[model samples]
Target: MSKRLIVVFFLLLLLQPYPFVWSAEQVSALSKQPIKTVVTDRFETGVVLTKKVLLPNGDLYWMKRLEFTSDHREPYTFSIPLSGSNGTFRYVERLPAGNRWATIPVDTKLPQPSGFLQTNQMSMLLNASNFYIKNVQGTFEQQPNPLPINVIRTLDGYKIHVHFPQKKNSIAEIWGLESKESLVDWSSTPDLEAIWLAIDLQEHSKWSWDGYYVRSPQTYTPYSPNMFWRLPANYAAHSFIITGGSRAADDLGWVMLDTILPNQNREGYWETLPRSEWLWKDYGIGAGFFDTRFNTDIATLLLKGYRRYGDRHFYQAAEKYSYYLLAHIDHHHYTNYGESEGWLPADYSWKQPHKKTHVSLNHHLHEMNFLYEMYLETKQEFYKEMADKLLYGVKNTKSMWIKPNHDLHYAYLPNGKMGLQDYPFLTYNDLVESQSLFVKIYGRMDPDLAELMANKKQWMDQTGVKGYRFFPL
Candidate 1:
């Protein structure tokens, strides 16, 4: 062959797509074998098998590596999946060492001995004083009262473990913090029994200091730099916590509701930015525009509040938000694609022409869930019809579902674009989340949908960021 032709041939070979195995049977077989130095078809952007060790107990540890080959980072912002039957998941920088692990529990029902009403496992970390120990350890003998805590790395965040003397009532505060630089000396214990009895309660039991709700240590605050002003979303979330049952839930619940009522706009939508208008204005997004995501979240809280207090007002507020969402549905594509415009601008009345609409499968699913719940409560056909339409659109969209084999199918997106040429390369977690949502909402509706659901679940069980066991591509 000519030298030029040989070069062309080698380039053709290099251009071959990543040869991922796309079947459960094949992946399961490969997983049982010993590790290899180099994994076959190991795409740089995908999971690469580095080593597999077989323990004496017959358990295998597959050390797979994932350095995302592409630049898309949004969906792959890593999170440890909820394992077993527990309804708990956490955001960790890395996976845990053992399969048997438990997330540090958060109890909204119990008040901190002296901190704030809106305190959780995370919020308590704001004040170092909340980190107290009953029985001091020898190693921490030289350490100060707010001792250096031992923070264990988990899939999402730190699992703090303060070593107690192993006695029935002995305890040490601040096992460790992820960032030691932020540690401060905190020394106050209002109710020592309550604080020591429940290790999970991090924030001490003092309602709002001055005016601002005490912020949780785990709360992501980049969006709103100021922790002082309580946004509607935060207020609603804090209110939802107290509805469960606590000695202070009744008083705190009324306080949250009273604070939330006045924020409602003239059209009944709640304004989230009485204090942080410039925070959003920088994005060309208007200040008073109500967010569907926040409203949906708050609506659920209101529904819970209604259930807890048996108040007609809570029910009415939830229904009001639901109606606002229904009215904002993108009428343009309601028939064409069965999609509802997911977001609206602050000055939508005047800025409608300039605002470019947005929608995604996940958003649609979330809205459908809210609408379905409303339909159940009101027995309204309108909400049911809306939910059914979204389900039907997802099921019928040819571009959305990809079935590689009889037992394996998953979903992806060209991000809902038209006339896309390349096969969409997307995140494994996104597929799991969206496809699982599809299965959850529509699995029982039809046999065909149920089969698709089963396939996706099977695929998800085997799929991971380290390496997808079986992928279509």
Candidate 2:
């Protein structure tokens, strides 16, 4: 193949579902009978798993240990082998209702599988010939349960349908899954992993409410119909957009941008391409809508997209945001509740009187990093200078927020105190990455920043970013 043709072929191949096909026997072995965690009416549950592990640098192993359950007793005895133990399987969230993100132990007896899989994901081994993924959350309430799959109700002594959790990242997990319930058995998996892949790498040509267009306003979120609930802004907020640098992510972002840009209010601070857009219906819930941090992140990604796609608007968006940050380089009123500091706003948003809140270590550092990237891309010294000034805020305030064990308090509270809680050790990862970015920018790292990074990493090594869902670290 010629180079150009080879490149095309490579992308086409990449678009295919995870290339592991199970044999007739492989399918039969798992489906004919259930591979379960229950024993004589008791359960031997494992930890709930996610597509990505919070801890860095380790491999994800598959589990016979389906740990998400109410029962806390020891194994009554499991249906599958539980060997090669590494971690302990501790509970991250202990809420009575049990609505939380759970964690895996430092070491456990988990079997390494043929390819990537999560304890939460259905192995394609389950016979789901009936139901379909109705919406983003894989809700199946409206669909008919003709397959007798998940049809067992109260009279049947069933409390909740027992099945594996299926939160696939790529649509790759369900390529050949078109079986019927009669020939197959059931429909339990949500099987909704199309959030990243643009329906097999094909473009939507135009955005529509009917199709997947990179999540936003999900029917009940803010700026969505009525703010019925905030719909998890922390992880879901910038993640889709932050997934922007690569060609595939850019493809998804185009659809997402189309959804957002068309209806945005765009009447906030930063007035530059970097300015915040006011998309709320109430008119004035949050002024400026946090253009400083959120828009800065968006602008940097836009810069990346512009460079690769060579679009003028991309450059314009980032250009405005970068200038906004620079224009307010001396935001004295917005700093540490009193003293003049160059930190970016993380917890709250406003620009007129400059709404101030506790300084978020992650937000400040992230903005600093974004500024440095903007400098590198546009060859501007001012962005770097601003980033340098922002770095000083972290160093001076480190002792105030960082615990002696190196775990970070989530933010510098407005009451002139450090928060009691930490982010399960996420700040450590931020500190480590920030040092690398600065090192690349200045050809060396700051001594104070370097020391902080070292201590944070040591802390991470000792405890793999363990955090609870309801309560923070």
Candidate 3:
């Protein structure tokens, strides 16, 4: 062969895609074993895996991971033993993307006795001076109290150790053990034990919504050059809109936004700014207008708030925004696509050639459903008509349903591809949302279609993605 021809051949070979290869030993082990062990210590109880199975495509995967707990009731630890003789395998910890695990010190020493006194209960005792106590234990023959002292539990019952704050002169006193049975008699106890337990847990639980820590410099932020008023105002707006007055959600959202928004506004939106030196200057202008997403969220919040509180002001605001969205629908594609047919460009930038094409079917469906509900509330013919058209367009659009495989149903790509072999990969969130939209629309229109969608949603739910927007009503 000529030297030039040989060089061209080498170039061609380099350009070709490399096929995935598996070792013969690995394949044989995977086929014969049909099981692999996975151990997870996420929950209070640890999980154990014991079996691995080979897929039809020869991909090795796990079949079942049996869970054997050390403590059956509480489940603190679990263990699993595999029987099959498989070759040496490497263990991989599946940490969430972009997050790193850090090792922290563990305190193993037992707490001191004086530190075990309950502060809140002690305060109440100090204030009252006269309180009835139930003594389940028979250890103390003579009851020491101002008025009433009742004992009900064994002396050596399971003792709970508690730590008290350090003080100059803090006194610790031991009371008779209170039996769980004594809590059944409400007349004698006045306060329900379950209610008190819940209250105690609420006071002590580590699960709290104190807000996001703003010190993390790597987080995303929406604004730059912190203006004190702007930060708090933006935080309040985001909190109220996203959380719907839930104090915890509101606080967390606010804190997270505070930390991330500054960096996000400066760095994140730099590409989308009008006077940017970036290759795509027009991209910035398009992004500035993309604030419509926030408007959409605000409209939703207003509508929900109005529904909950019957506030006419909120209703009026929602009505105005709903009309604005309805007015923007392209009437030309109404027959083919529906009210939302040609709305929302395929890409973030409006200048792109793929801009006007269909993007997220799920987002389109959600917009349709939202408009439909608004139509119902206002009895607007335009809103109603748009909702109906969008629903019809979505159902009939073959491009919207890309059958990637026999088991997989994917959203359409810009080039009408079936696989994720295109830009802007479809996610589980998109699929679930689309399914939910279909369920919502069909449930009201056709019960059979609704049922089928619901089953599909259940299957999606089993994939381990929780808090899916769609749940059976």
Candidate 4:
């Protein structure tokens, strides 16, 4: 035969389902008998076949143990009032509750299966999925149940009814179903595909609401809808526009360029706003806070915009933000910094005047890393010079947060003090953040320092010191 003819012959054979036919008399005989039950009970019990032994190394251990086994089964089906096309009675939901976005209630009732079947077969095929009998003769069987049984294929799975010659209201279970439910092919249904597309389009359309871009409607608060602007909402917006192709890029990017960035300060720093409609303030509840965390994030966003659009304005904006943060380094009035020595205040400005004197090792590492990023971006000697000074200040100052063994002091007060009582114990978070920067900075600037940081990272990983723990040596 030709290769094409041979291929067609095999394809036809593959499409055919296995034939398991029986005579009318045989069917009637099987129908009268109960489909044997298949039960799969799962428990945490394990067999300790051997006794515990004490080792020479002062360790107690079990010799041999047998773990529990599990069998996937068709869960028990409760007879509910199913809707029927022929019958007048039907099922309906009296109450509907839940978010439409998460779940939608189907008000229309579905018609019940036309027929039911009881089976004695080891395995049964229904709706292209398989159902297998898990137990036979009161013992769980690894193989499927034997043939000569009645079975009905339904939307959920094959429903097997039980029958006893002399007993009524008898229950027989068939567990360990190979297939439990029908899998819907959404792409095969044009209407469902269209609905899915509409939902996706609608979701993307609502990315930006009111004036600023938002992650979700759940994050939306009338008083401060733009609060996430300080967080990662702006970055998410920029990323959405950049990665989401022409439609998102044209609409959202245009709004960002024309409306959003222009409304902010000339130095390119966004002020904290108490209300969505309120004007930006310099020194009140939400004002004049140059945080390294916030500025660095915004600057990175602007830098991404510059790289994508080849817009000089974005670069200038990013540079201006870095400069603004750099200017507030000492912040002499509120911060307790001498002429030659100073720590990077966590927050500096009108709102957190008192906290300006409170130095944090974590925040200090963040600022230093931000400065280094700025240096890399602009290649400005001034930024590199500031980075050098920060490196020196963190290491040499009276509030040296890192120790010789690479253990980190959580935070430092203005009095150059840090430990568990006043500050916090070293955490995995603190170690990773500070050590990451240290490795990065030292790798580029000083190899010796980098080696030390590498050792610290190794020690931390090996020791398994996590949570709020003493500085792991």
Candidate 5:
């Protein structure tokens, strides 16, 4: 066949109907003797056996697999052998009160078939004496006491029902017999609610740290010892919400806030103290300063916590950090730093000063946006004014806007012309972080801007880009 025709044929085959297998005599016998009562260890029992009913074209006809199980503590095994070309079934072990069962798949296409066939050649050992006898081809043996059985046929398989006494409350096991040496092992007992409850209890217990919330799996180290300030912020926020804003929750928040505030302030620009020998020797970044991406997240979280809780201590700490960010703002009209403008080269270490003063827009936007929220939540005029100036400054600067590209929506560049020479991917996490700050800021001043951001959010979701990590560098 030509390549295109071959492809089309394969596509058509993919769309073809599934095969079905069943016997008309077996169906008639099942319909006549609807149910069977068997003397077994269990007070109540039910069995369903299913086989595929196929059409001449090798496509499936509607059917369901037979299901069988007992609710008693009797060690029993059952098996059904397929005398025809295609046959499959499943056995189940059910719980006491509910309709939940543990299932096992049984396919009669195993390599060996001698052990599966019965000695009498009339019955399949469902479980010792409890047998489903095919007296002849496609015909079941007539019983003195015919049982009421429910047979349901569906697109995938068939369901045959065999009923037992309903008074017994014990659990049972089920097995599918292929032969003496081969059987489908399936066993189960019901405790559904208790299982879920136990899991939930264990999860909560592991997630809790001395009545204060940690994400999951209890840890020895406190939240503050984790290095990054964002940890404490998230822990505090989540704990408070989980506890429904209780006093104890508020206290934990305060404790974490108190612990993180000092470190944040030390990292801020206002701290004029000399660098510790270790700080300079190890980090190589100037005295006790937090200029990393982590610092920005920490600051944002702190500000958010303060806004939500209305704590004076948190507000004061936020104010100190805000002041630090403000001090570093370049107030120049054209270029923030003249010909020395543009992004700081990736190779350029913060420890050694370069001629250019390229600031990451992500950091700048986040800090300014957070400060703006603080202003709105607290009605601080200075914050509002500072935020406006920062926004205006960013809009006029050519260094801040990135050029469009195939690899990324926009790229942060040291110089506008270079256009993502270093990094090329637009990551979902980065976009969410940036957009979150943008929404928070715009929501306060311009609702229209926030709405536009919301529309962009739809695009992010529809393209399935919100969760993917797409960074090229």
Candidate 6:
């Protein structure tokens, strides 16, 4: 071959993807076989691999190694979502030796005493554990954090660069535990838990922490910065503490309430933000428009916090927000089309009702749930009456049903049009809670709500456990 041709061939060979596998003496806790490394597939951006290990006991376990073989011109921003059995999955990180395993027992009201190490130590595990990684191996380092790391920015933002570097053929690993036998009910929806868990991991992944929240950098892709302040995030919280709760969840939930109480405005509200609909843009009102959605959401979560921790402060804060929700309705009905009477706006102004604004489906659901809870707590028929009115609006005015997928509409606009589909699990969760409240209050399920829940469940099963959004190339 010509020398020039030989040089070109060498470049092509070097750029081509290479897969790596390593066998470790590490025994799988479950399969009890020597843990084996498995390489999966390669995408345009990076290669993906599943490093399977025996779960300490013979239970099923999957270890995933995320890394790359190409040199990026700049720091690479990486995010790959997984679709799991629309059921129960636990994301447990392997810790260093002498600090291997500890668990928060299910249903324990108090946090487990931290004798071994805090769950946060799992972060350290990413930097140090390399049993699953390929080209780049890691040494198990203990608590004081022995690895010297750097920080760099990708398209996502600046992160604690584990030096999970953008070097040729580097690897980093993160472990996740999936349980299909436990029969988690949402059998087919995307495994958002695993998706979110991947943020902290750096199987050649970047750990970006913006200045705003040291621990919480821009973890999500830009378009999907889903409702940092616009809507309720109960589902995100759900992913955090399922069944057997954790110390992290307990602490985070408590701190959230504590922070909100002091920061709430005198009118029993936080600074209002806009709504999201089409393509992650604020198609609703701009900022400073106080949406009733926020009040209802805060109130509902506070009520939950009160129930969980018996905090009077939580109840007090929730009650204030509850009052705010009822008081802020847009009585003028500018976009009034369907059962417009007693319906709320997508957002409202403190000075006057937000006329000409759109109607929100999530508002109806959240407001209904919040008001019903108020009635239960305070024994006020007024709360039930308002909640019933909102329920009536949904049942009579809106055609939220998506028969094939069983999804609900996102927003009801002035032109009698509904645009966008509700997040796969959000509305379903709302309907279930609302139905339970309806049953508790009136001793019977609301027929419409029951149907909605049933349909939502079906949709969830069909969609299964896969991340909803795909980052555009």
RMSD of each: 25.3, 18.5, 27.0, 28.3, 27.7, 22.5
Q: Residues 37-147, candidate 1: write the lDDT tens digits.
A: 334344424432333333222322222233333433222212211111212222111235622212333322111122221111222222222211111110101112332
lDDT for model 2, on a 0 to 1 scale?
0.39
TM-score of each: 0.41, 0.45, 0.37, 0.40, 0.36, 0.48
Per-residue lDDT tens digits for candidate 3, residues 267-359, read: 112122221122134223332322223344445555655454333444555555554444334421223443244333122322233233334
Model 3 regions more than 4 Å off: 1-285, 291-294, 331-358, 398-402, 405-462
Q: 1 or 3, which is superior by TM-score?
A: 1
Per-residue alpha-carbon lDDT of candidate 2 for residues 275-352, written as tens digits (9 for 90 to 100): 223323322323224444455555665665554444445555555555445544444324432233545344444444
| By lDDT: ranked, best first | 6, 2, 4, 1, 5, 3
Q: Between candidates 3 and 5, name the one with more favorable lDDT.
A: 5
Candidate 3 overall lDDT versus native: 0.32
Please, what are the lDDT tens digits per residue for candidate 5 over residues 303-341? 655544544455556555555454444221123443323
Per-residue lDDT, model 3, residue 199, is 20
Model 6 lDDT tens row, 188-277:
444633434433322222211100011111422222221122222233333333321433334334434543575466777765333223
- Candidate 2, residue 334: the lDDT equals 44
RMSD of 4: 28.3
For model 6, the stretches where C-alpha displacement exceeds 4 angstroms are: 1-244, 272-284, 291-295, 330-344, 347-355, 398-406, 457-473
By TM-score: ranked, best first: 6, 2, 1, 4, 3, 5
lDDT of each: 0.37, 0.39, 0.32, 0.38, 0.35, 0.46
In order of listing, the candidates' clash counts read 24, 15, 24, 11, 35, 22
Q: Which ten residues in a row have the lowest lDDT in candidate 2?
A: 170-179
| lDDT, residue 333, model 2 | 22
